[model samples]
Target: MSLYDEVGGAAAIDAAVDGFYGKVLADPLLSPLFASMDMTAMRRKQKMFFAAVFKGEANGADGYMRSAHKRLVDDGLIGDAHFDAVALHLQATLEDLSVPGHLVRQIMTAAAGLRNAVLNR
Candidate 1:
């Protein structure tokens, strides 16, 4: 089963995204990066991104991730540490939602694989 379905599909992703942003916005290290972002748009994109990834239909995700963060990477606002922080927040969000540990690990592994793309390396 896809991770999206395994974790309860759209509803789960929605909750996870909301929970993730709640933590991220509260995090001093991560919050500043989103100071002027259009959160509604950001959240919408996140939902679409996660849905595509979890559904195994992320055809252009790598390129998308690279382009999406290119500016931040160029400005030095994004780096390994920031990526790790985001990953940690994602993991915590999944756990907080009571997702099974095995699935969480699977999801995290997939996320980790995107590190290079996200970091624009």
Candidate 2:
């Protein structure tokens, strides 16, 4: 099974995204970056992006992630600290959902692999 399927597919991913972003938006460090944005759309996009990533779908194309996050990098609003916080939120979300430990690690690894691109490093 794909990582997506192993993690319970779209519904699971969607739920995680919701929970993860709730934490993110509540975080002082991350909240400012999203203060002016439409969270509903952001959540939708994140769901699509992560679903694509775990499913190995073309929609998760490298350029999309890079481009999508480019403005944040350019504005100096995103860096290792922000990325780490996001990662933590994701980890916590998965854990809270009771995902298998090994699978959570795998998912986190995949997320970490994208840090450079996401941070525009």
For each candidate in turn, the TM-score is: 0.97, 0.93
Instruction: Give the poorly placed runs of model 1, Cα more than 4 Å off.
Output: none
Per-residue lDDT of model 1, residues 1-80, tens digit only: 88789999999999999999999999999999999999999999999999999999999888999999999999998899
> Local distance difference test, per candidate?
0.94, 0.89
Candidate 1, after superposition: displacement of residue 47 in Å? 0.6
lDDT of 2: 0.89
Q: Residue-pair clashes per candidate, as listed?
A: 0, 0
Off by over 4 Å in 2: none
Span of 10 residues, lowest total lDDT, candidate 1: 1-10
lDDT of 2 by residue, 1-121 (tens): 8999999998998899999999999999999999999999999998988888888885546677689889989988788999999999999999999999999999899888888888776
Decoy 2 TM-score against native: 0.93
